[model samples]
Target: MSKHFLRPPGAVAEADFLGRCIRCGKCALACPYRAIRVAGLLDGLEIMGTPVILARKSPCYLCLKCVPVCPSGALESRVKKREQVRMGTARLNRKECLNWQGTFCRSCYDHCPLFNEAITMDGELRPVVNEKKCVGCGICEHVCPADPAAIIVTPRGAG
Candidate 1:
């Protein structure tokens, strides 16, 4: 059920996250982008008060500020760089993408923090995800021009 959402960077694993997180809002407080939120009752009882990011609402800027402040170590303090983050991996829906549909929009590729690294232009001038290079910061999803978003992020361990 939690597969629909994404945890902050440096999160160990879902099961371990739940066990280690103390429901403190330090992560949310440290997030200057306001991308992180504490799960509420409606989010489901098991994850209540835990941090989560709703990409469309706001996206992580890879600030790496939240991890160090997590008193419970739920967000690993060892994560100090964007490349080390394993928040999730972004996937694009070709059918919904303007570039894939022949309109030629590079919003996702242009805005990606990883630049030419994570999302690259293919031979057909369409955006392609270099999965291994993606840090799943959600910038691609946030920048998508498509109505329902042509791109989305799949959190690590979500499967």
Candidate 2:
């Protein structure tokens, strides 16, 4: 399993998700942010046409629109809060982060939808990720100004 790949909010566990998903593309169509995309032929037959979020290209905004449209139970329909979504966790690369290097930069912190909950400023004003509070929406990664984003969201269950 790729550590960088993410499913939409309310997605079931990997095994169950594969079994339950119908590849209807409804989830992709319903996404307001167009964050959800169908797995293409290169993704292999087992996951082809299934919904995936490529966070770097476009991160899930926690709009919750894709969940309700899933005809299959792959994504639960009852999750109502952004806090309830657990796509993955954000990992910070301090070496690449400007704030950690004594520069003033808060792009990751400023763009985080979870704000103070998912990302907080340390005494040095560097962004610190609170894994338990992070929903792995990848907004921080998308908004980062670095050549390689200083912060990245690792998908849940990834090794």
**Cα RMSD to the true fold for all candidates:** 1.2, 1.4
Question: What does candidate 1's lDDT look like per residue over 4-114, in tens digits?
Answer: 678999998999999999998999999999999989998889999999998867989999899999999899988999999988999999999989998979999999999
lDDT of 1 at 82: 95
Report the CA-based lDDT of candidate 2 relative to the real structure: 0.89
In order, the Cα lDDT scores of the candidates are: 0.91, 0.89
Q: List runs of model 2 lying over 4 Å from the truth.
A: 1-3
Error (Å) of candidate 2 at residue 11 is: 0.3
TM-score of each: 0.96, 0.95
What digit string (tens of lDDT, one per residue) describes model 2 on residues 1-159?
253679999999888999999999999999988999899888778788889998888999998989888998999987789999988999999999989988899999998998788999998789999998999998999988887888888888874
Worst 10 residues of 1 by lDDT: 1-10
What pairs collide in candidate 1? none
